[model samples]
Each structure stands twice: as C-alpha cells, then as structure tokens.
Target: MLKRLWLILGPVFCAALLVALLLVFFPTKLRHDFEAEKRSAVTLTAASFKGRMQKVQALTDANHRFVPFFGSSEWLRFDSMHPSVLAEKYDRPYRPYLLGQRGAASLNQYFGMQQMLPELENQTVVYVVSPQWFTKTGYDASAFQQYFNSDQLTSFLTQQEGDAAAHHAAERLLQLYPNIAMADIVKKVADGTALSASEDQFVGLMARINKRQDIFFSSLIPSYNRHYDQRVLPELSRLPDEFSYQELEKVAIEEAKEHTKSNDLGIDDKFYKKRLKAKLRELKGAQKNLSYIKSPEYNDLQLVLNQFAKSKANVLFVIPPVNEKWMAYTGLREDMYQQTVEKIKYQLESQGFTNIADFSKDGGKPYFMQDTIHMGWLGWLEFDKVVDPFVSNPKPAPAYHLNSAFFSKEWANYDGDVKEFGNK
Candidate 1:
C-alpha cells in the first residue's frame, strides 16, 4: 500500500514542478492586439515605457500611425491642447505615443531605445529637449535606477562590439548605478572586453528569464494614465465639427486664463497651490548661478543621435522654454540659457537634424507655459501648429551625418560659442 501511494504522489509532484519551471523559464512569443495597442499607445506609465511588447506592437501596428513623443514631465501635462488630445479630437492622421515622465532624462531615453530599435527604425519621432536636463551634474542616478530597463541593458551590452559609444554607455551605466543589477555583465562590457563562453550563456539565460517575467507580469501593468487621457474625450466634444485655428486659439487662452488665475506667475492654479505657495519667497534668485552650459548630458544625448542616425529616423526636435516670470523669479541668466540652446542646436543641425520647432525664446509669451517648465494650453497649441503639419504629410527622408566626437568629454564640457559643430 505504501509503495503504491508513493508512486502516485511522486509523479504528481514531479509534473507540478515541471510545469512551474516551464512557466518561469520558458520564453513567450507575444502576438499583436491592435485594439489593445490603442490604449497602450497613450499609456505613458513607466511600466509601459520599460517594457518592449506594448511599445513595439503599438509602434509597428499596420493600422494606426503612432508617433513617439519623447520628453520628460511635460507629457504628463494633459491639457485640452496637448498633442494627444488635439490629435484625438481633430481625428488627425497620426496619434502621439508619449514615452517619458518625470526623471526620464537623456541617458534614460538612450538605454530605453535599445529594445525598440526595430520599431524606431525609419520611424517619424519627436524629442523634446529640456534645458533643465543640461544641469552641471547631468542626469540624477537615483532617478535613472528607478526607471531602469534591464532588458535594454542586456540588449546594449550583448550586441556591442567594444566600440567607443558602447564603451562609454557601459561605463556610464556602471558609474550611475554602483549597486546596479547584473553588475558582473555590465562591468565586463564596460571593460570593452569579450565575454567568456559561460558569461555569454548566462547573459542569454538572463535575457530569457527577463522576457518570461515580462510576459506573465505585463498584464498587471497599470492603465491608469491611459484612462486619464480618455478624460479629454469630454473636452474633445467641445471642439467644432471642423478644425478652426481661431476657435482653438480662443479656447486655449480662455482655458489658460481660467486655470492660471491663481498665480501671476502663469503657473496652473492647483500646481501653484500645492507646490509653490509654501516656498514661493524662498525660491527667489535660487537659480542665479545655475547653468546648462557644460555637463556629461551632451555625451548621453550623442548616444540618442547615434542611434537615430543608425535607424535613419525622420525626427522632429522641440526646444521648450521656461516661464518668463518663473525665469525671472529664479534669476536664471538669459545669456547662459541662450548659450545652452545654441549648443543644443549646433549638435542637432550639425548632424543634419533640422526639423526643429524652437520655443526656447517664447517663454515670455503669456499662458504658453503651464508652470515653470511645462507647456500649458497656448503652448501646446503652438506645438500642434508645427507638429500636425509635419506628421500629417510626408517629407524628405532625414540626411543624418553623425560624428563620434560628440560622444567625447571635450564636447560635453566645451563652453565655446558653438555656432557650428564639426561634423567630422
């Protein structure tokens, strides 16, 4: 009786263990769900940003045209005139897929691009270059670690040929997150050395494990942001049946006026009440000496340009401005800010990236900014004017001529009057 019972239970336990192991270790092949991708396209949550399935499917969808809107906290400023809302309300030819949130800077975007290289290839994309990201110290490591995508890291490390860009990226990754995950693999990659047979096998195994985890757990990712975007539907109803710039302008100014009345600073009422009301005075002249002229962020941005050139993506670069009142209160020097903008423009135009919508000098325009750094109702309208036409119609393909020197420390720290970049 004991032997018979043991035989039956042993097989059952063995079968259960096998199933569990397969569930955790086996790779999953995800299929396309176009309808589901509509929501995923607008879902700007970090989980969505870090994962590849949702983004790749939405980007490569045969039916819908989802253009990537890469920026930081500005994407979360969901007003009626926002690109997502305007596009949805107007029934435009393309939909904007937001890719960043607070704390997502240049380096964050560079690594995040690794997994979706195929999707980004030949894609028409927009990147909002924030002046604040050009701080002397550059990207904040703690913030970087919070949105870290291990899959992208694996892709970057394993596919590298010990090239200059790869070496720089690996070194930065190791330095940024001292206690970063997969330090052994990252350190080896940073050394610009070849991986051993066992290590190579281990990296591949980890990649599989990461993919398995993403597959089973992806459904649990939040859709709250997508839902939040749907609130624009009511606002969309308020628009005319036909598109009219005059009508939209009236709406934008009225909306901005109603929302920004609480502060003479042109900041949104709720934001001012919550974030600035307490320390309003203490922040005066706080940025008197703060500068954007020199930082390693320039090097990190080169990684993005390098990737785009390789992809041959037709790209649009947006330069956002600080609120004039806020800029004055903070005492940030205009000359210094202009120098940074000039440097940023030099980097882009020098690389043949010329489709730019520059609002860097429009900070003084009333109601253009929602707060200190983000675009409000009027600003988004101005953004739509340029962006809608670009994405709606076809254009000449990008003629990017990339320079590796932009990845060097000299360019990162160079404070010269950069009228032109040496595209050598």
Candidate 2:
C-alpha cells in the first residue's frame, strides 16, 4: 500500500518541484503576447484597470502609441463615436488604454497611479473628470475599497514621506481599510510618523516580491473585459468607410434615437425599462437637495494633479456636462453645476495644468448626453473634434506650480469664482 501511494504522489511532487525550480531559476521563461496587449488597450475590465504590467507593456510598446483614458463609466458607453471605437475605426495615430470603471473616482485613480509611475512619466494622458463624482460626502468607502489594489498601497507607502498628499492618502486608507493587511504601516504614515528601519526593510522586501508576483501572474490573467466580445471587433464594420463628422454624427443621432425611444429623458431603452422607468416619478425633484459644491473630491483631485505634475505628463482634462432635461426634471440647479465646473477649472489652471475640453454648457444640446450625466451622440462627436487634434498634434509640456493649500479642507469646501480661487 505504501509503495503504491508513493508511486501516485511521486510524479506530482516532481512536477511541482520542477515548476518551482523554473520560477526561481528562469524567471523570464513566461512569454506574453503583444497582440493581447493591443486588444487590452481597449479592454475596460476591473482587472485591466488595476494591473500595471499590461499598462506598462502597451504604454512602452515601440510601434503603437496608447494614451491612458482615465475616467469612470463613460468609457464603457462604447457608442459608435466613443473614443476607443472612433480611434480604431479611423485608424488614428493613437489607441486609448482605458483605466477606470464604475465607482472609480479620484481617490481610486490617485493610488492606481502609484505602481506605474515610471511608465506614466512624460506620457500624454486623457482624464474625463465627472461632476457627478463630487457630492456632499465624497466617494464611498466600500466603493474605494473595491477598486483599489493592496499592492498599490504598498507601492504608495514605500515611496511616501508622509507629506500632505501622503498624509491624506494614509488617512483615507485608514478610513476605507479599517483592518487593512498593512494597517500598522498605514497608521504610522497617517500619524505623520516614519516607519521604523525594520518596517522600511519589510516594505522594500515586499515591494520586490510584489513586483515579481505582478510580472509572473499578470499574463496568466486576461486583461480584456471579455464582455460583448462578438460586438467588439465587428464594430469597425459599422463605421463609415472614411472619417466625416457630419456622417458620424448622423449615425450617432440615429443610434441615440433608436436606443432612447422608450424614454422622454433620452436615456437608453433597456436601462430605462430596467432601472429608471419604474422609479421615474419618484426620481423627479429627488436630486434637488444634493450639492456638488462642497466635497473632499477637490482635495482628492489635488492628489492626481500632484502626480501629473511630478511626472511632467502632457494631459488633457475633459469636463463633461449632464443631461439638461433630466437636470430640470430633477430640479438640479445648472448655475450650481457651472460653479462646480469653474472651481475644477480654477484648480487646474491655477497650477498651470491648462489643457481643458470644457463642455460644461453643451448639456442643453440635443442628444448630447446618453443619460442624465454621461456624454452621448453629438456630445461625443464634439468631444472627438476637440480631443483628436490635441492628441494628434504635439503641444508644449505644462509647467505646474502645485499648491498644497488645494489639499486643505478650506479649498475642498470653497465654492467661489475662478478669480477668487484661493481668496475665498
């Protein structure tokens, strides 16, 4: 019986040993596909959002250029004129490597940048900042916890001096991650205390291990979202033989009309029927009391600016408008909405991060928003018009003069004119 058992387990043990030997000896034995990396440039899955290996690979690829499109659900809209589809259909000079999904706000995006600092250095990036993200309470803890990677925190803690951004990052992590795996280290940073020599050694060691682990396992995982796979490639067939804004907008309008026929709100039919049609009446005036003027997001946004400034990245910040009819139905104030836009613009311009595609006043235009607050139809076409030239052509690098004061609670709560950005 013992001999038979040894025979059964011996081969398995040897195989495991050989695999371990290969990992320790031939670390580079695992190969990756650049084609998959190309496909992943358009993949907007959560895994792709957090994984840095795929991003570094595509961003560094010599032949093709992939710009990082940092935003939330807007990227998933994937309408005929969406940035990704349009880029592929037109065979533009660059492809977009989308980096966020639902609930991925400034706080989530800031930390996600930590692990890819080297790749991001000097790269041009597009960030679509949504006004809807700014609320009275700021981002939800559960939501932040869901999209953030622990390795990202490890990378953050390893490089931080517990400065204002570091302090705020540590504090937010403390709140969102009550029992975080690295709570002890995070606590020290939050308290403005340095990690002990041993803690430093531990962090450095873990960083090495995490780096290797990420390299080893990332390829095993598919970077593509894998949703509507059948439709992703065939989408190219739907585009006009050549690029024409008038022709494309007509298609966009046609699509918007067909998808939004079931609702007066101009929201997609399936989304309306399943999500809003039943609650339509109750939603009226429900958003009247909500305010975007005061929130921690302003400070959270400062962290992103600080990162971009540090990296010297050429960036285009796209500020989108909400659906005006839906806003009126819900009694949301447009003046207040404009104030939010102005405040965000002030934060960007005051620091010399000046390239902006402000569509703040375009919400009232027909079919501009797919739903209450996301871009659609003519909105995307107009967006493409502005964005295409910016990315297609070269521009002078921005000179950022970052102010730590933006991270203060005062600025986070301030809702003043652009001229009085700090005076208020």
Candidate 3:
C-alpha cells in the first residue's frame, strides 16, 4: 500500500519541484517584472506624484510646516516651478509645492489632502477651485490605486466614513483590478524595443494613455462634453472626407440650439451666446451659497469640498478661461456675462473664500488652445500674473489684467479666416 501511494504521489511531487526549479533557475518572463517596474517608474516619475511625495517627505523629515498648493492640471500650469513671483510679492521666502494632476477632479485633491494629512500638521494649504471642479463627481480613484497601497487608501477613506460619496469612491477603487496581462504584454513590447528605454519612453506612454483615456472616459461620462464653438467646430468641420462636414455642421447647430434652450439662454444665428452668459451668472451665484451649491455634479462635489474646508485647508477655486473665438461663435451676451461675474463674486463672499480666482474671461478672448482645453503659454502667464499676488500675500484682493495683447489675436484671426474660407 505504501509503495502504491508513493508511485501515485511521486509524479505530482516531482512536477511541483520541477515547476519551482524552472521559476528559480530560468525565471518567469521578464515582461511581467518589467511591466510592474515600468508602472512603478511611471508613478515615481510623474511630476505631480513626485512633487507631492517630496513635499510629504520634506515635511516629515524636517518636522517643519509647509504650504500646499492644490488643484487640478489648471493649477499645475500656473507658477509651480519658481517661487520668485510668490517670494517677491510676499516679501518673504516661499516654497509652494504643487499637488495637482492632469485630469484629476476636486475629489482627487481632497483625497490627496487626506492622504498627506499626517505630514500636514500646522501646514498652510491653498486650494485652486474652478467652477467646473465643483461639478465633478469624484476622483477616478482606481486609476491611482496601483501607486498607493490599500492600507494607506483605506486609512484615508476612513476619515470620511460617514460620507456616502466618499465611501462609494473607496468601494469603486477597491473593486478595480489591474489589467496585468495587457500591462505585461505592453511592457514586453516596450522593453524589447529601443524606444521603451528611451528618456521619453515613460512620457510617451503616459501621453498615449492620457489621450486614449481622455477619449474613452469622455465617451463613457455623459457630462464630459467638449463644447465646440467657432474655434473647434471649424476644425472639426474641416475633417478629411472621411467625415461629412455637412452632417457635422448640422449636428453642431442643433446641439448649440439645444444647449441654449436647455439653459434658458437665447440662441441667435444658431449660436448659444446667451446660454454662455447664463452659465457665467450661475457661476457667480454659486459663491453666495456657502453650505450648498448646485453644480453639474453637486452631490458628490459638496461632500468633497466640505471635507477639505473642515480639514482647515484653504481652497482656491479657479474657473478656466474660455476661448474668445468660441465665445464669439456661441455669442456670449454682455449683460449675461456681467451677471455671471456678480454671481461668482457673491458665491466667493458667501463662502468666505477670498482665495478664489476666476480666469474664465481672460480679456474676453479665449485663452485655451483651439484643439485642446488647456491654456496656451500666454494664458498660463496671465493666470500666473493673476494668482501671483494672492500666493504672495494670501490676503490681498487678487489682481487681474485685461489687456488685448494678453490674448492671441493670431488665434482669433485664424478662426475668422477659417469661417471665411468655409463660407467661400
């Protein structure tokens, strides 16, 4: 009986040993390890991630208090590298650390603050809030879960145990599974080629992923609409013969009308200028309701904001500037625009958030690029100028300049030229 049992078990035991030997000697695919390493490297090298971690470490090591500048990509585009503008304006030494990431919503910033709280004792925190941020649902927490450990995230979320929205975000992230197989395949392909090891490899991968993610998420999320106007519409209308310009034009006009009607703003000549004005008004009014503000995604955002405020972090909400050409195409009326500004002012006063800055009307011309929602260098410079005094003083009324030259007339002309060409 013993001999028979040994014969039956011997093969199984031998197979297991063999498998172990293969793993130890020949090793599993470098692709899997390489992919994991690549992901780690990307996370480590991310400007926002690295910056935040450094700040946390610096504070922890020195046992000194520091200021944290938090927001989304819009904040990152502002004076992150140099404190010169801040130092000069404040008349004191300043080292403002950026904790903003591209595509991150307000909830992400709030979560980030929670994670860094242990190191943030007696630290000054400045938040940059955009009107759009208040409308965000929550953080795409799953995206960053790989970079952070479960225990760390759990502890952070525990602070918001009573908040339903926060709990939902935590649950969603916990349920996410990394696409290890695909990640391994891509990493192998990246490693096999010289391109993978290039200095720009990580950046290139990130750029590609970001582009794909933007397209994917925009399609998935109902609220992530890219409102095309004279600036972007013209380009889309000029797409190669693969797309029907006539069809696109019809769609644009119909959509524009729908937007105007829904918002109770007037649409003239198939443009939604009145609606834009109304949106501005709504933004202005948001300042008045300190306890609750309506947004595209109000329920989730309010909780996030409340958490941040309660934590004693100064929040600076910034409304990104729109393109002048787009405004022209959409037809933003003056009275509507003025009303919007007043509402925003009221909201700021109501909330007692003096650190807020609105760049939505950068000299009435569009400050964003035609193809992308991102601000151009000129716009970024203007944003920097506006926020400079505040970062320095944190008490003075933030200054704003409305110079015509501050806008890119070249871009405006391009829009006009496109329209003329289209007409011809």
Candidate 4:
C-alpha cells in the first residue's frame, strides 16, 4: 500500500515542484504574457488604461514625496500641459499626477485610495469628489473588487492597518475575483520593469483610446437623446410640468420603477433618469444623516479624512464641475444643488479639511459633448484652469512639490502641451 501511494504521489509532487521552479525563474516573462493578454482583452481604450497604469508605476518608483489628483473622467480631462502653463504663469514648479478613470463613482474613488495607500501613505492626495458620488445607490462594491486584487494594490493595502483598509480590502477581493486576478498578473509582470513609459507612446496611446471611447460613446448619444425625447419624456409628461415637491417625489418613485423594468440598450432615458433620481435621494439622505451624526457612509468618509489630515501628506478634495445644461435637463433644482453643496461643505469643515475646494458649482459652459458624459478639450482646459494653481502652490503643511523632472521630459513630447491645444 505504501509503495503504491508513493508511486502515485511522486509524479504529482514533481509536477508541482517543477511549476514552482518555473515561476521562480521566469517570473517576469510569465507575468508579461499574462498582462499583455489581459490588457489586449480589455474593451476600454488603451490610452486610458495606460495612463492609469503609469500613475501606479510612478507611485511605485517615486523616492521623494508625491501628490496625486484623484477622481473619475471629469478629473481625467485635466491637461498635464496646463500644469506647465500654470507653472509658467505663476512662475512656480508644478508636480501633479492624474489618477482618474471614466465611469468611476465615489465608492470607486474610496477603494482606489485604499488600494493605493501603500505608495500614497506619506504622499499628498487631492480628491475630486462630486455630490453624485455620494448619491450613487446600490453598494456595488464589486465594481472595484478587481482593482483592489491587483498585485500592486494588494501589496499596498496589506501594509495598511485600521478597520477601513482591512474591511474594504476583504470585501472587494471577494466581490471582484477575476479583476483581482488579472491585476495580480499585471503587477507580477510589471515588477522590475520601468514604471514609466516613453512619452510619445503614452500620449499617442492616450489620444487613440480617447478617440475610440469618444467615437463609441458618441455614436450611441443621438439614439439615447431620441429615445429620451420620444419615450421617456412622454412618460414623464404624465406628471404635471409644474409639480409640488410631494407630487414630484411621487413621479420620481413611479418613474424609477417603470424605468428599471423597461431597461434596454437602445434608449434608456427612464433608466438614466431613474439613476439620477436615486442619486438625488441619496444626497438628500446625506443631508438628513448629517443632522444625526450617525450615518455610516458619512462616518467612513470622516475616518478617511481624519487619517488624511494627520499625515504629512497634503490632501485636497475637489468637486468636478459639470455642465449646467445637464443639471437642468435632469430636473435638478437650484435649491437642491445648493443643499447638496452645503452638506459637502459641512462635512469637509467638520472634518477640518481646510485644504478642500469644491467645484461642483462652477458655472461654466457645457464642455461635455452632446448626449454624452465626457468632457471635450474645452472642458479639460477649464478643469486645468482650476487645478493648476492649487497644485503649483500646494498647502505648506502637506509639503507637496511638483516633480518637474518627470514633466519636462517625455511629457513635452506628447500632444498634451499647451501649444498643441487648438490644432486638434
């Protein structure tokens, strides 16, 4: 019996040992192949992915203290060139890194910070948060699980203690297994390789991907608008045009239900409208919960804020500016917007975030393209106008300095420079 068992186990044990040896010996190549395949399979534009990856790489490579700008696409629209321009304008050095992704909500941003905490722990962090982030419903923690699982992110989070980091990391890992696995593979491959890419490659890739995402999303915009007008508007018309608050509330609830049921890809006005309404409800709830001082989300945000405040890192929370037309079209009232702003201010002030700046109320021209959520160059320019100054003259306590060494080199090669702005 012992001889038979040894024979059966011998081959299995040898195979396992061989595989371990391979991993130990050719880790980079194996990791590279895995990453390349994973990246190639991603449906989003390559430039976007590259930009995000670059930020992670930069963080990993940085020996000096660093500051990162965090948010979704709205913040992504910030032109790196504008920082140089702003630096020239103010005659100050500018060191800013963009860490934004399209379609990312508030929860996503929170998770991003958690995953990036390792490199970010002692660094300055500026967060561009919108009320929309607070208003997003359904805690789809899974949305960010894959991101948290990446080797870099996992390594970073493991080093961070406290309830928030551990709780979020565990929850996200379980929810986004495939993503986590993919990220791990990418990190394993990226290890030891230069974190930075060639300037030309970075810009070329970003422009290409931006164009692709725009073209894809733009093609769908007209149809979405048409559907909103013909189908959704008519249904919403069933409610009185000038409705009382209670009547509007009833309409919002009923419309949300019907919209969820009629969900389709062709034209999803009801679906979009429903999400907007749900977000509004969440904003209102944040306001109510603020009075009580016991809201879990609010509390969580406060905890992170406190952590940020005490660290040597400079932290700023920026609220991205949105198109006024979009707000009006979505039936958002001025009072509603103001109340939301007030709530945000209260939260920031209560948490002692004097370095914070909220731009959600910035009354700028609609820089977004028609029927889509992305910002065009003009919008990006406007975004930079607000951000360049702050980054150039970062608050003294956090002690963030612009790393022009990274900027003046490869960044100058890209189309992101101020001179190339109108050519496109």
Candidate 5:
C-alpha cells in the first residue's frame, strides 16, 4: 500500500515542481506572447489607452522645460502650443506637459503624478480636477489599468496600509475581478519582494487580456489621425508658427457654422435639455446620500494630498467650471455644491495647499462649453485666462464664487453661443 501511494504521489509532486520552475525560470520565453501579438493587431484610442504619455516622453526627452499638466478629457482641447501663448501673455517662460486622459479619476491622476515626480520635483505642476471625481465609486480599476502598469498598482497596494480608502479600493478591485492574480501581489508584499521582470510582464499580460479582451480576434485593428505630418512638426509647438492655431481656429469656425444644423452628434441644445431633465429626475433621491466626506474618492484624495504635501512641489489645482443646467439637472444646488466645494477647499487648505481656482459655478455660458461638460475652443480661452496667470506666478488665486441665488433660478433654452468668439 505504501509503495502504491508513493508511485501515484511522486509523479504529481514532480509535475507541480516542474510547473513552478517553469513559471519562475522561463515565463517569458516559454509562454506564448499573447499581449504583444494582440497589441500588434488592434489598439484602442480612449484617452487612457492612447499613446499620450509615450508621446509626452518623446517630447520631454528632447525638451526639459515641459511641466506635467494632469487632468481628464475635459482638458483635451487645451492646445499644446498654449504654453507659448501663455509665455507671451504673461511675459514669463511657460511649458506645460499635458497628460490628460478620459475617465481618469484622482487616483489615476495621483499615480500619473508619481510616475512624473521622479523627474519633476519642485517644478510648478498644474492639475485640473473635475468635481465629479469625488463621487462614491471614485475610479474604476479596469479603466486605470489601461494606462498604468502593474508595478504602479503594486506600489500603491503595498504602501496602502492604514489607509481606509486604499484598503477599500483594493477590496473593490478584488471584488470586481476575482481572478486578478492578487494573491501573488499579496505574497510579494508579505515577503517584501518586488515583482520580477517576468512576473511584472505576466501581470501586464493578464491585465490586458482581462480588460481589453486581447485574446480575442477583434484586438488587432488600426485607426488613423488626419494631418499626421502637420502635427509632428516642431514648428506646431510654437505660438508664432500659426499652423495649429489656424487649424483649431478653422475647426471652431466650421463647428459654429454647423451649430444650428443638428445631426447625430447629440450636442444640440434640445438634446442637452432633454438629458438634463432626465438626470434631474434620476438624481432626486440619490443626492441625499451623497457627501464628499463619506466618499471612498475622498479617501484616495487624502492619499494624493498627503503625497503632494510630502513632495512640497509647486502645484496649482484648477477646479474646472461646470454647466449650470447640468448641475441643476443633477440635483446639485449652488448652496449644496458650494458646501461640498468648501469641504474640499478646507481639506486642501488644511494640507497647506494654497492655490485653488474653483470655476465650478461659472454658470456654463454657451461660448464656454460645446456640450454639457466639455469646453469648446472659446471655453478653453476663458479658462486659459485664469490658468495662464496661475501658471506664470505659481501662487494662490482667488476662488471664483457664484451666489446661491444663481442656482435657484430656472434656465430656459440657454444656447451657449458667443458671437465675439466666432468673430475671433
């Protein structure tokens, strides 16, 4: 009986040992390269997935003057050459390193900041924050994984002790995706071991497969950017060049000309009105439970604040302006939103963050925004007026405030059109 048992268990033990050896020793060369094959086939162009950081790295490798400007898709319209415009306007050297991505929450931004901080300490950095980031869910890990590597995730996770928000984020991450190879991360954290190169590569491969369905046939696809040559020229980065400037101006003119003629873009005034009404209806009961203090987002926000405080980097936090109609529709009264913003401001102030510019209640004038949230060309100009000065001085700016009465009033057919902007 003992001999028979040994015969059966011996092969199983050896097989397990052999597999472990393979995983530890030859993970890369032995395993099939699914992610690379998939990437070589098809790639997504969401702000987070796009090659913005890679492009920024290429630019920064050549130009050391660029300072990272972190934000969401809301700031995507901000021209790369705007720094030159700022330099001219403020009569001070200005170079902004824009790294905005779609659906990026504060956690994602914080990670991006960490990646840049090694090279950019004590430099003036601009962060454009959206109020919506303070919601309960905070950030989606799957979305974040597209841009951030596993090493970043591991670092955050390993250093996340005593942080309720970070703990909760990890829990949420694990709960959302059960088979995330987190056990390996946890083991590494326990052993004070960094993930090996092959291990890191495996984690990355798993993330891409899980998030983007890279194993499937639909992964290999191609997309194009029109006027690629025009964009690549270094002259486009200068204000005097007038190439990008004219292109954007022409786009604004064309957009204005076709404004009244609505099609399937769903950016018309009526469409927004309808959506606003529906959102107002949906958020009626939900607003009661909403508080920035209790949000998981605030927890991650606290972590970010702590990091900035430690770095003592010159940072300017710009609160992007929100559309009044959208705010009202979302059941956020000026007073209520103001209270929330005040809490945020207080938190920042407590952390010794002096420079905060809240454009939250700018009333979302037609010329300021193309849709309910996204700023248009003229909208960016108005924002630049505020940002350009802040970037030049790197000092505290007065928060733009709106009276409580502004929110109480009802808006009717507020088409955000500015003839002045069009003529420019």
Candidate 6:
C-alpha cells in the first residue's frame, strides 16, 4: 500500500514542479532571446527609414531620451546633421529622431504618434502638418492602417486619460496571451456560445482579426528591446545610405532634362497666365464650398492634439507652404487654402496649441519645393531656421507667422474688396 501511494504522489509532485518552472522561466526567456536577436537586426538595416524607426524605438525602449520630428514625405528634406532648434547654433547637441512615411498625412501622423507614445511621454516632439490634409478626402485607410493596426492599439486609442491603467492592463493581456482572446471567441462561436447573438457581433470579431493581420509589429514590443529587431529583414542592411547633397543635385538635373525633353517645361510667358485662368475657371465650376474645419480629418487632428495635451510631451506644429503653380494645376484656390489655414490656426490655438509656423501661403516659392508637395533643400533650410528657436532651451512663448505678405487674394481672383481671411 505504501509503495502504491509513493508512486502516485511522486508523479504528481514531479508534474507540479515542471509546471512551476515553465510558468516562471519560459515566457521571460522567450522575450529575452527574441530581443537579443533584434539588436543585431537593427544594424543590418540602419540606413532605411523603417530601420531608423526601429533603432529609435529600441533606444527609447531602453529609456534613452531623444527628440522626435513627425511628418510625411514633405519633411524628408530635414537635415539632422545640423543643430536642432533645441540647441545653440554652435552647440549642435540634440539629435532628433525623425519619424515619417510617404503620404503620411494627419491621420497617419496620429497613428505614428501612437506607435511612439510609450517612449515619447514628457519628451519634446515637433509635428509637421500640411493644409491639404484638412480637405474632404483626408487620409486613406491603407495609409493609416499601414503603421497602426492592432487589437491593443484600438483599446489604447479609444480610452481616456484616466484609463491609463486600463490601457496598460489591456496591453499586458494581449502581449502575454496573443490570439488567445480571439481563439476563445472562435471556440465560443463553434460551441454555440452566442447562437442567438446579432450578426454585428460576429462581423465585429472577424473584423478585429482581419485588422490584426496588417500589423507588421505590435506596439507591445519594448522600444529598446534588441530582440524586437528580428522583425526586420537582413536584406535591409544592403539599402543605400541617406541621400547626399550631390545625389539630390544629380536627380534635379535629370528631372530638368526630362522636363525639357517632354516639353513639360513651358517657356512662353502666356503659358502660366493661361494656366492660372483655366484653374480659376475650374475652381468656379466645381462650386463646392469646402468646410475643412468640420471635416473628419480635422476631427482626427483634434484627437491627436487631445492625446498630446494628455501626455507630458512639448509639442511644436509646423504648417509648410504649398506651391502656387501646383495649386493651380490641382485647381485649389489660394484664398480657399488660406481659409483652411485660418481654421487650423483657430482650432489649434483654441486647444492651447499655439506653437505654429504658418508658411502655407508663402507665395508658392519655387526654391522651397521640389514640385508642389515636397520640400527642396532650401525649403528645409528655411524650415530649420524657423524651427530652431522653438526647440531651444530658455524656451520663449512661440512665434506665429501668417505670411500674408507673401500671398495675395488677387491670385485666386477674389474681389480685392473682400476682407483678408483671419481666424474668423
């Protein structure tokens, strides 16, 4: 009887001990080893934008502080080799962590902000905005989802400031047992757990999982974790280095040659006048009064600002200029665009976000842009100059410039008698 009892008790004790060891060590080791692999992965792709973000995320994860400049392709010309606005001209001390993706408008920036939130709390961040983003179309779904698509992100974004605990708790739950929640739902569905439930419930669960598939990496990955680097491909290391001044010059020359060859370079004096007249005609024909202030994109912008207000991050918003030539080609009026700027300014100032540089109506300076949208080197230099004082220490109440002197209502063929657009 004693031998039989010993046999039963011994096996039970062994099983309990094994379970304890696995519980304490397995997950921890898995996370640790994965991060170790990620650090090596970063060096493999350091030159690429995704790799740069990964590197910064890792550094932030490690608790190292750095400034962040968030925007779209328009800001790609920003020179990090120079001193940040935060530093003295001679000091060149602060290193900015630039976060951007092509066509990343307002909504994408919001999601990008979400991506970097864990590391950015209480840090200084420079955010760039384009007026076109306020238009009806706003950001497309693909652009927004490419950077931010995850179950945990949905919870964090939808919650309030006081729900920080809930946000963190939700994040921990998802990271610890990924796909578990979804799996349980699937099991319940199979077991007829909600047989009488509405169609919306089923649709919602499937939608949630579908959204999860777009996430290349979840926000749960520690910003500094080296193991997180494994998500990057080794081939990324082979990418070319950052664009050099010489390379830009070469590209510009090539583009000019192509333009001349294609007769896209119109030399006749009447060409621009005809083009402007045609654009005015088109604008008049459309007859759509764009209420940009009430658009969904503006609502998203408000959400972004609200998130910033809740955090400890010091925010600076830059409103870059659009090309006059491109504006006409696109059939967008200078006056209407000016109105959009005012609406943005009013909304931001109302929310106490007054640190804005309104270069949106800068008479469409050709030197400032490569084309209608992207900044050329001179444009970036101008941006750097304007941005410097704001980022510096001994911080003063930031300056605001409407730059109306650089633009005219006459360009849009608006009656000269009409009042100048302000924050009305």
Candidate-wise lDDT, in order: 0.82, 0.82, 0.40, 0.41, 0.49, 0.47
Model 1: what TM-score?
A: 0.91
Model 1 lDDT, full chain set? 0.82
What would the TM-scores of all predictions be? 0.91, 0.91, 0.43, 0.48, 0.57, 0.53
Residue-level lDDT tens digits of model 3 in 370-395: 11234433444445555555545543
Candidate order (lDDT):
2, 1, 5, 6, 4, 3
**Model 2, global lDDT:** 0.82
lDDT of 3: 0.40
What are the clashing pairs of model 1? none
Model 3 residue 190 CA deviation (Å) reads 41
Q: What is the per-residue lDDT of model 1 for residues 240-261, given as tens digits with 9 covering 90 to 100?
A: 6688889988888888888988
Per residue, candidate 4 scores C-alpha lDDT tens digits across 130-173 of 55544423234554443332333433333334344334433444
Candidate 1: stretches off by over 4 Å: 1-31, 222-226, 420-424
> What value of lDDT does candidate 6 attain over all alpha carbons?
0.47
User: Which pairs of residues collide in model 4?
Assistant: 95-402, 146-180
Model 4 stretches astray by more than 4 angstroms: 1-19, 22-56, 60-66, 75-96, 114-118, 136-138, 150-157, 160-300, 303-307, 363-378, 398-424
Q: How many backbone clashes does candidate 2 have?
A: 0
- Per-model root-mean-square deviation over C-alphas: 3.5, 3.1, 20.1, 18.0, 12.5, 13.2
lDDT accuracy of residue 51 in candidate 1 = 80
Clashes of 4: 2
Q: Which ten residues in a row have the lowest lDDT in candidate 1?
A: 222-231
Candidate 6 lDDT by residue in tens digits, 141-208: 55554554443343333332333322322332243335544444333333334423553355455444
